[model samples]
Target: MPSSDKTPFSRRALLAGAAGLAATSVGVASWQQLRQPKARVLQARCDSYDANLVGILLEGMAAFPAMLAKARGGHVVLKPNLVEVHPDRPINTDPRFIAAAAAAFLEVGAARVTVAEGAGHTRDAEFLLERTGLDELLRPMGVPFVDLNLDEAVDVRPPANLTRLGKLPVARTVMSADLLVSMPKLKTHHWAGVTLSMKNLFGTVPGHVFGWPKNPLHWAGIPNSITDLWSAIRPSFAIVDGIVGMEGDGPIMGTAVPMGVLLMGEDLPALDAQATRLMKLRPEGVEYLRQALELGATVSKHRIELLGDVITPRPFDVIESFHRLRA
Candidate 1:
């Protein structure tokens, strides 16, 4: 049946308008030195809804001009958050962002680059790639697709306090990458509170080896588990997609907030702390960040230099359970 348009009061139009209105509300800036397309955290308030803007934003945040000169000869591995099979609205990392990022890596002269994610909370990586639009984006690029969940596993020693999980079988793809880029989405989690770059490394290990320890990690406490994971896998770079951050009931059935921001950094803690600050949530309050800080994971703000939007912080509608009550 050919549907007749009655009055154009559809949910798609409403949501699109809602998102566009939020994006267009911000003022545009000339490509100043501070807000140039080469900033470490390129946060342009893009008015246009075109997906091509993903490429522009990626070039900006990655500071491609500078990074490419240095990364010209190495293999690059992009690890995006395909933690679930939900739509891009609030579940996984945006496919446009990932494609744009992968393209940027190629532009910068990466000998070869590949996008990989070990689907855990979700069963199939290809399903996530399709749902997130990554399949179409990577089809023409000839990038290798690796299902981490189905990869050949190699046993490795667990870090201190994590031996209960025993020797874990890690995905060979993640283990062999010369340069690992952690591409994570900005969202609150029911259990982990916030799933940033550091926590996203969970997808690197095979479920067969690390799944059992999930309970021990949580039971022992969230921070320690995260610290253990960080120690296990060290990413060379990080890119946090905050273009549309998730707020309440996040990482799954959460509401999306139009943050319109992208962050990048060489140090995981430095970038994660900056992201935590932007969320207007106390970094010290986040158990994993706090524990990472305690473990000397580079939380010192003095060491980091800002390169993008001079954004004033805004309060995230943090869940009460996640919020810490100070004495």
Candidate 2:
């Protein structure tokens, strides 16, 4: 991971460069040009990692296939938050959710469901997979896992110039996917505030090309990198694992908090906004979330109707110092 302080680059310089790209990327045009998306309800299930949990989760996500018309009859990609493993803290997105999502997608008519992720922090993707227990969880489902880092690369340009980044080299598998399901763990992040579906898109950029943790983007600014990458990939849908979330010092080192809930939505910003509030933080306070709303019509600001076991997230054990770091 690149240090925020001594980042081999300067934020001032990056923003200056982004200013020039902004004119071409996310044009200074009318908001009507970027037609806002409709609000959709995604059902979430609160379940632990148990045998019966997958079945219950599948039932909760039953509406997804029909909800995302594009997903049906297309190749789907399940991107779980497999950052790094920890026996004590629930840092990564639970594999149970990934398994359940894969099963649900296949049930709804997805031609093929491939489980893929580029472990940004870890050099060896296989070790990360095995330690995270995703290997065991995906095997029975016969879901194949592909290391996005080693996969072929392709250049992509987002229609929305939401960030300073220009053409990005994303994993070929991710570029060609008909549907991208951002399966991310709900956790607090020092730089991005809270990393949900949008932040999770960082893994889609092959580390082999960009460097572990994708430092080039970090040099560009974590918030800027996220918005740029998200617009480029634009995941079709999302499932956030809040069942067990990390807080305090997170995304890796943080105490586990049992929020005991799962959140789903096609509008990731709404989902991320809801997740941010669930963490007791404001959505507008987070740079990327605000940018997400800016790109759309604050679709999440209107509130996404929550379905299935709707409950307020348990107060997470967030870092006290960051509590005042709200944007």
Candidate 3:
């Protein structure tokens, strides 16, 4: 059922809105002058969620963005992995990280920051919010949450020949944001190899149009859809929650692995590539990322410049068992 309280964002409205993106001035200008040099990625060692997450976030981003200056004032949207809520399981992006992120963005200087997700599994986006405790978690941070599942849909022209999917339905808020952050929990998946910053984008589409579990995207082919979404949305930053990450079979229903490090980068493919390296999995081993590589849009080893901590490959605790499934 589509949301009764609000109307869906139509194609005409989104076109008008996207045209207005040029007027944002600060962020749009930044993009115009944006430089991607050797695709640098920064890492910070954080043993546990109890560590000074915000401090780690700050130190690694010392050279982050000029928008950090208060006068520039821009809007930022945080897209965290909130697929399903099981308090005992390390299933979603840790709320603490989200809180730390909200604080960090404000401290640096963002005029507006919102948390948005269109959880694919369940239909009750609100109940899911309460069950996940995300509502309470974000309430104190003064960051508002938008249920993208019901938020008006907008027509988006995806990259040609990227996927069988042509124009995808995207949330208007996602399209309008100045800086969109892809915040994902590092997890191994039965089908996709592993879920990282790029896969986290599944939540940005409205469930009302796509249906529960985002079936249309799955029908379009997971690898194809992934490449298409990453190409179109093009997130400004990626922050992977690797602290107490899931190892076995996941995004959900996986065992937790205590690999405590946060991965940060401006390039989505670089982050995913670095993520694949950290997990000791070959980047070419993941079908979607390899497909991304073919498009000349994703990161290759030569394109990445690692900063902060040394790259240490974590043990693939349960990959041996699930590895054969993808084969």
What are the models' TM-scores? 0.77, 0.83, 0.84
Per-model C-alpha lDDT, please? 0.69, 0.77, 0.79
Question: lDDT at 227 for candidate 3?
Answer: 80
Best by TM-score: 3
For model 1, the stretches where C-alpha displacement exceeds 4 angstroms are 1-70, 156-167, 211-221, 325-327
Write model 2 residue lDDT over 23-65, tens digit each, in one string. 6665644343345565554545565766465566566666665
Model 2 bad stretches (over 4 Å): 1-37, 65-68, 159-163, 297-300, 325-327
Q: Compute the lDDT of residue 27 as modeled in candidate 2.
A: 64
Candidate 2: residue 229 lDDT (0-100): 80
Native-to-model Cα distance after best TM-score fit, residue 151 in candidate 3, in Å: 1.0
Lowest lDDT sum, 10 consecutive residues, model 2, at: 28-37
- Model 1's lDDT to the true fold? 0.69
Better of 1 and 3 by lDDT: 3
Name the lDDT value of residue 71 in candidate 2: 70
